[model samples]
Target: MNYAYLSSLFRKQTGKSITAYKNELLIEQAIDIFKKSNKNITEVSNKLGFSNPYYFSRVFKRVTGVSPSVYLSQIYRN
Candidate 1:
């Protein structure tokens, strides 16, 4: 019920911190949104609950190893 207990359970079940799981979920949502819409990175970032596109891009690249723009470009190239 508390933060510490929940964090422990999360680590035990998934081997990742809660923040990492949330970011992974957000990035997955962002990828789906990006693939479905023609909106720019800022729009996609905002839709995924990020206040700043720059921060969103950093997180996206960290999780995905590529920026949102680059991801979309690759999709287009295929």
Candidate 2:
């Protein structure tokens, strides 16, 4: 199948665009990293293959309703 057709099928099956799904997975990984490691946001973002920390923060906020720094603070507080 072509890229468009596969993307449409993926969206129909998963109810999210491919990029959205990928970002969600990345954010999930980020959460795990935050909980288990001492790495900061930039390191996590780079480890997850994000081009830049700013974009990573944007995606993290979009998926988690909080920025990476805020999420880290919350986790670390507990």
Candidate 3:
């Protein structure tokens, strides 16, 4: 239940650190919320606890290979 043990177990199973996994999960959830809601990037960023939309867009693109606006456009096109 401790931090070290949990991080070890998480890394063993996922081959990534807990922080990386959590950030990935956050991006995935952000994608879902963006696609399903009418909120703009700044609103979505705020809702997800990001201090600013620019930082959120950076993390989103880093994790998913697309900016939030681009991702939303792609989803809408398909």
Where model 2 places Cα greater than 4 Å from the true spot, the runs are none
Backbone collisions counted per model: 0, 0, 0
Better of 2 and 3 by TM-score: 2
- Per-model RMSD to reference: 0.9, 0.6, 1.8
lDDT string, candidate 3, 1-78, tens digits = 899999999899999998888779988888888778788899888888888999999989989988988988888899
Whichever of 1 and 2 has more lDDT, that candidate is: 2
lDDT of model 3 at position 14: 94
| Model 2 worst lDDT run, 10 consecutive residues | 69-78
Where does candidate 1 clash, by residue pair? Answer: none
Best by TM-score: 2
Q: Across residues 2-68, which tens digit of lDDT does each residue of candidate 1 receive?
A: 9999999999999999998999999999998878878889888888889899999999999999998
Q: Distance (Å) between predicted and true CA of 32, model 1? A: 0.7
Q: Candidate 2, residues 1-78: lDDT per residue as tens digits?
A: 899999999999999999999899989898998888999989999999999999999999999999999988888788
TM-score of candidate 3 against the unseen true structure:
0.80
